[model samples]
Target: MESFNEYHIDPKEFTFLKSFQDNWQAIRDEFIHFIKQASNEDLKLVYDILGPKSKTIKTKGDAKYSAFGILFQGMFIEKYIQVHQIKYPDYGAEEASQKALVLREKYFPSLAKLIEKVNFNDDEIIRNVYFGTFHPGLDIKLHVNYNPHTNRGYLGLIVPEGDVAMKICHEQLYWHEGKFLVLDHSYPHCPHNYTNYDRTVLVVDFFKPDKPREEVIQFENEQVTQRMQENPYSLGVFGKSDRAKVEDFIKYGFTHQLEWDKAL
Candidate 1:
C-alpha cells in the first residue's frame, strides 16, 4: 500500500522480519541439511525441477533462475503441507488449495510457528516459502521476473550464508547471511555467487491484497476453470515427478562449485 522504489525496498517497514532475523541460526542449519540430503532420507525435502520457469517454465534448465515454488506464483510445495493436512483436518478443508492455509507449518516446528505467527498477526496473507539455491559463475543468477501482482511482501530473500550479491539496476547489493533483501521484481536484477560455495536463500513470498489471499486464489481459479472449460489446454498442473532432475541439477551446481573452490 505504501509507495517504494520500483527496484528496492526498505526492511524497516516490515516488522515481521525480526522473527526471521532472530531465528537465522536455526534456519540456516535446516537449509544446509536439506541441500545435503542424500536419497533414501525422509526428513529432507529434495527440490524438484522448478518448472514453468522464465522460458520452458516447466523444464529444469529454465528453473535455475528465480526463487521457485513454493513457486514464483506462490504455489505450495506439497511434501511438508501434506503432513499438516493430515495432522490438522480443517487446515484448508473449506478453502482453495493454492492459498487456503491461514497458517502453513513446514519441516521445523519452530519455523512453522514463525510462519503461523506472521500470518496470524495479519488478517490474511498468501505466504509461500521456498528454498532457492544458486551455484558459482553466472549460472546461479537470482533473476526475479517483474511481477505486477505483488505488494509489501513482494519477495523477501534472505541469503542464509554465502558470498553472493545481486546486481540490480547497476547496483551491486551484497547479501548478508540472516539479513533481508526485500524488493520489487519489477526492476531486472542479477545475483551472482562470487565464491564457489552455493548461494542458497530462504525465499518468502507473502501476497497481500485488499481481499484475503484465499479469496484472491479462489477468484483466479474460477476464472481459469471457465477458460479451461472452453479450451482443454488452457491450463495444466505441473507434476512432481522430477526428483532425479532436481538431484542432477544440484549435482551439477554443487560439483562445479566444488571444482571452482579447488581451482581457487
Candidate 2:
C-alpha cells in the first residue's frame, strides 16, 4: 500500500478529503483507540445481531452492482406502526413494516451499546450502525450522503488484498484490515473495488453530544415512517420498478438470510 502523504489530493475536487487529510492523524488515533478496546468477539456480536436479517435489509444498487447494508435503528417498522397507531391500507406495506421493526428491536440495544463505545463519548448518541459489504468489481458511483446533522465513521474490517479503494472527494485510500477512515458524508465520494474478493466495512453514524439518543431515535423513526407512507417501496429496497425486482425485495425481506462467516 502507498503512503497517504505520497499521494496528492486536490481540494477543489474533494473538499472533505482535504479536511480529513489535515486531521487524519487525530481521526486515525481515535479509531485506533476504539479498535484496541473492541475485541473480535465484539464484532462477532454485531454480526450475530445483523446476520439473520441479511436478506431483508436493503442494499443499494442493481444486480450488476450492489452494496448490501444492515441497518440498526430504534423501533422496528412493525412497532412503529403499532406505537403510532398507523393503519396501512396495503397488506404488503403493513407486513413489511412490522417485520422490519421486529428485526430492529431484536438486536438494537446491544448493537447501540457496542457502537457507543467506539465514539468515545457517551454523550454522542449513535443513531445508526450499518454493516456493509461490497462484492468484487462493485463500483459505487460518485454520490454524496447528505446528513448535515451527523458524524460518520467507517471501520474497515474485511478488505480484499488487491486494487480496492475508496475515494473521498480528491483523495484515495486503499482498503486494509483494521484501518479506520472518518469522513463527513455530506461531501462527494465513491468506492471502486477491482479485486476478486468481497470487502466489508462497519459504518457508524451518530449525532452530536447536544442531541440525546431518544430524540435522535424519534427523529429517525419519523423520517422512516414518512418515507414508507409516501412510497412503500422506499422502505429498504431502492430503485426497483419491475415486478421481478419487487418480488425479489419481498422475498429477501421475508426469508433472505445471511450468516456471519468467521473468516471475515
Candidate 3:
C-alpha cells in the first residue's frame, strides 16, 4: 500500500470549472453504469440485515449525535466475558475477514460480486466491514480517514427518499441506491445527510491482494491496538456497566477517536 501522503489531492485542483469541464461527466457516466449493474434484491438484503430500526452505536467522531454501525472488525459480542456479572462477546480484528466472508456469501452475494470485480486481489482479506447509518440532518465534520495501509469502498444501499445529499471531499454527490463509490480515506472528506430518512451504506476496508498476508495482519494489529488505546468504548471492549458511560460520552463531548492516532 502507498503512504497516506500519496492519496492527498489538493482541494485547489478541484475547481468548479474543472469538475464541470473534465471530471463531472466521467463520474456521472461511471455511476450510471454501476447503477445499471446493481441488483435491487441485493439492496433489500442489506436493508434486511440492518432492520427497519437499527440499534445505534457510538463512533470515534461526533459522538454527540446518533450513529449506528454493525462492525465486522475491531469489535464483537462475546458470550463468555463477564463484566459486572454480565457476559458479552469480545469483539476484535481477529477472524473478522472470515466473518465478513460468511456474511457476503450468505446475505449479500450480489454486493460481494460487485466488490470482487473491482478488488482484483485474489488473496485479499476484509480488514473492516461496517454498516453505518446516519439520520436526517446529520452533519459530519471534514476529517481524513487516514488509513493509507488499506483500501476503502462505500456502496450506497439506502439513501434519503426525498431531497438529500452526501459529499466526499469537495464533490457533492447524491446517493443513489445500489451505487458504489471507491474512496481513499487518507484524503479529507465529510458526510452530510439532509433528508427525512436515515442514510445507510456498506463501508469496506480490505488489504490489497498484492501485499503479503503477514504484512496485512501486522497492519491490522497496529491499527486495532491504536484504536483500543484511544477509544476502548468505541470498540465495545468494556464491561456491561460501562454501556451507560459510553452513551453519555456520545451524547455529550468525548475525545475524538483519531486525534492522536494519525500516521505522522
Candidate 4:
C-alpha cells in the first residue's frame, strides 16, 4: 500500500481476489499458450467457456475508447454496417492491428480445471468471465461504468506485464500477470496500451458478497449490452446524460505496428 499509485484500495476488499492470485500463473500460462496457437479447436474451447459470440455477456462500450461513450466508439457495427457475410468488423485500427482484435476471442480458455478450481464454496460470487484484449496502440479514453440495475459490484481485471498506462482516481496501476485488480470502473479512467503486443485482461464481474449467485447470473444473461445502453437505461431522452455529453477532453493516441520493428 505504498503511495506508488494514487488510490489505495486494499486488496483485502474482494475476498475472491486471493483465489484468483493463487491460480493466476496456471491460468495465464494456459491462456497465453492457447492464444498463441489459436486454432479451430481453440475457438471451440473459447465458445464453450464464454458461450456464443452473439451471447457474449460483455458490457456495452468495453475496453475500446470513444469521444462520447460506447456509442461512437465503434464497438457495435450492426447499427451502421448493413452489408457483410454477416460480419461487422472492428475498423479504424491500422493495418497491423487488424488481427489483434479478431484473435482475442479465439483464446478465452484452455485450463477449465484451473478456472473451476477457483471456488468460493457456496458464495460463487463470480457472475461472468471473459477476455478483454487490448491491442497495441489502442487508446481507451476516460469513461465510467454505468449500470443502474441492482447496484454494488466490482470490475475485476487480471492484467499481465506490459508498458500499458492507466489513469484512474488520479493514480496509476502498474500491471503484473499475477495481480488481480478489483476496481470500481465507475470512476473515470483511461488505459492506453502503447506497446507493440496485444495485452489481455481476464475480466470478471464480482457482484455483492451477499447477492444471490443465481440472481446475478440470471440478470446478466437476460440483459444484453445493447438493451442496457438504450432508451430508459440510457439515450438521455429526459435530459443529457453523462454519456450523452461528448467527451472532447479525453486524451486519445494510436500507434501502428509498422512504426515498430517488433511487437510481443
Task: Write down the TM-score of every candidate.
Answer: 0.56, 0.50, 0.48, 0.53
The order by descending TM-score is 1, 4, 2, 3
Error of 3 at 89 (Å): 12
Query: For model 2, where is the 10-residue window of minimal lDDT?
Result: 235-244
| Residue 83, candidate 4: C-alpha displacement in angstroms | 28
Instruction: Give me the candidate number with maximum TM-score.
Output: 1
Give the true-structure RMSD of model 1: 11.4
What tens digits encode model 3's per-residue C-alpha lDDT throughout 204-252?
A: 5655444677876786666655554454433421112222333444422
lDDT values, one for every candidate: 0.46, 0.46, 0.43, 0.41
Better of 1 and 3 by lDDT: 1
Q: Candidate 3: minimum summed lDDT over ten consecutive residues — where?
A: 79-88
Q: lDDT ranking from best to worst?
A: 2, 1, 3, 4
Backbone clashes, each candidate:
4, 5, 6, 0
Taking all chains together, the TM-score of candidate 4 against the true structure is 0.53
- Writing each residue's lDDT as its tens digit, candidate 4 over 1-264 gives 344231335456666556656766665665656656768764543333222122112223434421111111112122211211122132322321233223333332333333344433524454344455666677754554533222222222434356676656545665556665555554455667667666665555455454565675565444443433432122121112223123323321122233233444
Candidate 1 lDDT, tens digit per residue, 113-143? 6666766785435345555666554343333
Winner on lDDT between 2 and 4 is: 2
Model 4, backbone clash pairs (residues 3+ apart or across chains), number: 0
Model 2, residue 259: C-alpha shift (Å): 43
